[model samples]
Target: MALSVVDLYRDILPKTNCGDCGFPTCLAFAGMVVSEKHPIDGCPHLAPEVVERCNQELAEQYAAGKWTKRDLAEDALTWAKERSASMNLSDLPGRIGGELLDTDSGKALKLPYFGGHVIISEGDITRADDRELTRWEKVFIYNHLSQGGSRMPIGKWKGFEEFPNTVSKIKTMAGHVEAPLVDRFHGRLAELVDAAKRIGGMEMTGKAHSADAAFFFRPFLRVPVMLLFWDEDPADGFGATAKLLFDETVIEHLDIESIVFLSERLRQLLCDAADEAPQKGNT
Candidate 1:
């Protein structure tokens, strides 16, 4: 195998995204290297021996042919695909909540996605309707298959930031997901609720939670998320706040980065659905 960015991101580089590598994130740095934009040894965190190993691999790869920029794109997905390839296909359904289907080519796992379903077969993964998935959606799917999480949702929810190695992603979550949501639906929580339902979010009503609106979204079969939003109340000098929570078993289902990507997709879907829905004038 060539020394692809996937190898660097998942195996060689420190996943901390510590910024000591000149680029802001490890994925960025890996992409930079794959495009020959930077040296492989740019990351100071890597051991000299590790750097030497990567250099040897890259040298051999370069001798073979050029690596395309597109190849470097979506290192997470590449890593996930590589992981899925190494996994035992038969073991997937037992771990994740999916049905093993017999396709003419090979085995496929039919897993739930939001309310729809996706078929995961070697070299070919698509929605039940066969609609092409976005890059993020592909990452979300492959990450689920790669992890092969066996535990069901624990029925208890906690903030996404509580997960290990997620401290760096907290700001990302707040800025990209939370802030936009609060701005768009602050005093219009009713609209927010409608948007949630549009995206297959189940209203978790009669539940004891601090948020004014609560929804449970099973974005992936074994990976469910609780979206809690505190509507703005100007009378109390409070601003709208939002948080996406996960079951206690989330850490076992997907890595921290995938969890953040999943949330970003949720934000995009919710915002789009809200824009399309008919508005309610007032409560």
Candidate 2:
């Protein structure tokens, strides 16, 4: 069979997905190229041979030096349609009833609805009420606090109180939480999910999960403007996680700005973490 577009795109570059093209990953940039949404030149990773090969097919388009822009738009729309069709909220469980809010980063002590607490010391322990234990059932929360370069005493909470044994913490780089553009992007996400709910396409709750509070939404989109916190299982350590598991198509259609913001945030978050975490000198 002929080389698949994905394969072709991968072949011409390092495929390390370093985001040099200003896109989150290599494949995303390739999709834009194949769709003629962006020109091959947009990718800094492109080798001279690859550029020459692409030039032949895009000779006419390149005359105006608009190949990349044209292709980016085309690919973006196609990607968006595919994303919408592929989005599935079905697998996701139903929504919870309360609303709690906190900073995207998990550092803030907001969201009192869940009676959130922390263990500031290694031996520090906070007991949880068995009755309140059930409140953590079936939810998801993303904490942005750990995204900073700071190493917190979070692990201490690991064994404290009734904190679910299922809790998982995600550490990332810094600068994601401070980006101003994130406000509009997250606002849009909130609005979109709300709109989705109005049409019976959503399940939302505003509760914070202490154990897994920062578990959702990382590595994929880590912009400082927004942090996601959720509890997919209330009994499972607050269900907070950092995994970005949106549909492939939805992942494709994600607004570039949103993707950029999130990706940059994640990058910074990870960077910050490495800087702060104790490390041995090169052996």
Candidate 3:
């Protein structure tokens, strides 16, 4: 079996939590190395032979297609399909607020969504209008199916820190999801709104929060997320800030890891849209 990053790191590193790698701990350094943010040789404690072996193992795993995202997605899909095979497709609509419809292919669960209607049946997902499902959509649907929760959304919103076991990940979540958004569209509220609309996000008004802008996006049938932004105030010396809020029931539909994945995907979509927009003085 191919070793996981943790496994590889544990096998090669001294496991001493040494700060010699310029990180607070060796584990932190290992994480950076796995993410390709740091070179393997950055750990001065590692001997030449250990570094050579670690590099060789990484290369072998890559050659064997063990660490590819596609491979992981396929594995997750397979596991989800197995779990879904025993589920009652008819009951999912009531549980998750979707509609059961008879299609030419067969009966499928349809959920009206931002981009299009998402149709799910027997572990497969497709657009209701016969369009292709994006990769992110497929993964999201699979995770939704695998989780198989019966609770309905209560319309109560909470930040990631409030989710189960997510208090420790709040910083990571903010860095990955909110920071990038603030960096890309800090003062450009109109452009951000336009990008959000292109991705099927709806502007929400009259919310309790004193945000400069707020929008709602439904990434899945029952998973509603809210994005709020606070522009910088030079007089007050407050920097631009962005935050993501999830319905309290979000944990029922998808795990925290998958939630992070969706957030990152959202950030990517907004950034890509921003990049494609016409620049000043450009045709």
TM-score of each: 0.73, 0.21, 0.67
Per-residue alpha-carbon lDDT of candidate 1 for residues 1-283, written as tens digits (9 for 90 to 100): 5767887799888889899878889998998887663788889888899888888877777666557444433676777788778876678877887889999988888888878888888885799987778877788678877775789887887887777888898999999988998888888888998899999999985586867898989988788888889887889999889888889898888888788888988999899999999987744
Candidate 2: stretches off by over 4 Å: 1-4, 58-283
- As a whole number from 0 to 100, the lDDT of residue 165 in candidate 3 is 89
lDDT of 2 by residue, 1-283 (tens): 2223566465765688899888888788776765554667888767788787775655654454442344453444344334333322221111111222233432222211222322111111122232231111101111121112122122122211122221221211112332322332222333323332332222323443332222223121221112343323446544223223222222222232333334443434443444454443321
The 10 consecutive residues of candidate 2 with the worst lDDT sum are: 133-142
Clashes of each: 0, 53, 0
Q: What TM-score does prediction 2 earn?
A: 0.21
Worst 10 residues of 1 by lDDT: 64-73
Candidate no. 3 TM-score:
0.67
Cα displacement (angstroms), candidate 2, residue 227, comes to: 45
Give the range of the ten consecutive residues with the poorest summed lDDT in model 3: 274-283
RMSD of each: 10.8, 20.7, 9.1
What is each predicted model's overall lDDT from 0 to 1? 0.83, 0.35, 0.76
